[model samples]
Target: MPQIAILQMCSGIDPDANLAVIEDAAKQCAEQGALALFTPEMSLLLDRDRARARAWIESDGPSEMIDRISEIAAKQHLEIAIGSMPVATAGGKWANRSHYFRPDLAPPITYDKIHMFDVALATGEAWRESAAYEPGRAVVTVEDTPVGRLGLSICYDMRFPALYEALGNRRCDCIAVPAAFTVPTGRAHWHTLLRARAIEASAFVIAPAQVGHHADGRETFGHSLVVDPWGEVLLDMGGDASGLAFCEIDLNRIAEVRAQVPALANRRPIPKS
Candidate 1:
C-alpha cells in the first residue's frame, strides 16, 4: 500500500501566504510517511483578479515559487503534485498548468488543462475560462511514480470523458483530478463525476479540492475525495474546512477490480455516424 496526502486549501490572493501553507503541508506529509502530497487547483494563488494574479504568473521557466517547491521536495524527499497554477503562454494567453515535482530534483512534469470552463449557471455565476487561458493540446501521463502510472487532469477537464478514456487506454493505475469547483456545481456533480470516472477507467481517482470562502470572494464546495476502482468512496474530507488528510492506496485493488469488471478491456470504440 502506497500512502498519499491530500491538502485541501482555501487559498487567498497572496502567493507567499499560500507558499507557507504548501511548505507546512510538505513537512507534515513527510513526517507522516506519505510518498506524495497532492494539492487543489491554483494551490499557490487563487485570486480571481486576473491583473493581480498576472504579476505572479511565470513563463515556463525558472520561477521563485516553483524553485522553492522543488527545494521542499528535495529536502523532504517527497513527491509533490501542485494541482494547477497560472502560467504565461508564448501565444499571449495563459495556461492553467499542473506540475509534478520529484524528490530527486529532476525536471518537473507539466500538464496544461485541456478543457476550458465556460458556463453560466442558474445561480447567476458565470465563468469564461477560455477568455484568458489556452486549452492544452496533449494528454499527459507520468509512469513509474509512487502510485505506478499516474494520469493528470485539471478541474474542468474532468467533465470530458474522452480525456479519461485516453488515460484508461494507457492503463493508468491512478488519476489525479485536482479541482477548485464552485459550490453549486460541486454539490450537484462533483462526486458523481469522480465515481463515474473511476468506474470507467477501472482505476483509483484521487481528487484534492479547494474549499470554503476564498480571498477573491468566491465560495467552493470542498468534499475532497478518493474513490476506488469499483466506485467505492474510500475517503471524503467533507465540505467545511481546509486541512490535510492521508489515504493508503492499495495497488492490488486495481488488478482485482479489473479482473472483476474489465471495463477498460471490454471498452469498445464508438463509431461516428
Candidate 2:
C-alpha cells in the first residue's frame, strides 16, 4: 500500500504565492512518505476576474510552478497531480487543465477539464467557466504511475457518470477529481458524488478541494475526500480549515470490490431517445 496526500488549499489571485504553498506542501508530503500529492482546482490562480487570471497564465516557457514541481518531484521521487491551471492555447483562449508529473519530471500528462461549469446557483453564486476556458476534447488516462493506472477528471466532471464509466472501462485503479466547489453544492453533494463514483467504477477516488474565502470574493467548500473502491470514506478533511491528509491506497481493494460487485461488467447502454 502506498500513502497518498491531499493538499487542501485556500488559493488566491497570486500564482507565485499559490505555487509556494504547493511547493511547501509537496516537500512535506514527500518527507512523510507520500507516493503522490493531489491539489485542488485552480491550484495556480483562483481569481474572479478571468482577464486578470489569463494575463498571468502561461502558454509556453518555463513555468515557475511547473519548474518547482519538477524539482520537488525529482528530489523526492514523488508523483504530483495538479488539479487545474490556466493554460494559454490557440485562438487566444485558455484551458482549465490538470497536470500529472512523475518522479522523473517526464512531460506531464495533462487533462483539460471537459465539463465547463456554467450555472447560477441557488446560493446566488454564478460561475461561467466557459467564458474563461475552452472545454477539453479528450478523455485522458495515465498508465505509468506508482499507484496503478490513473484516470483524470476535474471538479465538475464528477457530475457526469459516463465519464467515470469510460474510465472504469479503461480499468483505471484510481480517479482524481480536483475541485474548487461552492459551499452550497459541496455541502449537499460532495460526499455523495464521490462515493457514488468510487462504488460505480470500483476504483479509489481522490479529491483535493479548495476551502475558505478567497481574494476573488468567492467561497469554496472544503472537504477533501479519499474514498475507497467500496464507497467507504477513508478520509474526509472537514470544511473547517485547509490542510493535508493522508490515506493508504491498496490497489488490490479495487479488484476485491469489482469481484464482489461486478457492477461495471453489468452495464448496458440505454436506447437512444
> lDDT score of model 2?
0.89
Model 2 bad stretches (over 4 Å): 58-62
In model 1, the Cα lDDT at residue 190 comes to 99
- Cα lDDT for residue 177, candidate 2: 97
lDDT of 2 by residue, 2-98 (tens): 9999999999998878888988888898789998999999998898887667567753422766777788889878899999888887766788889
Name the best candidate (by TM-score).
Answer: 1
Off by over 4 Å in 1: 58-62
RMSD of each: 1.3, 1.4
Error of 2 at 58 (Å): 5.0
- Quote each prediction's TM-score: 0.98, 0.96
What is the C-alpha lDDT profile of model 1 across 108-129, one tens digit per residue?
8999999999999999999999
lDDT of each: 0.93, 0.89
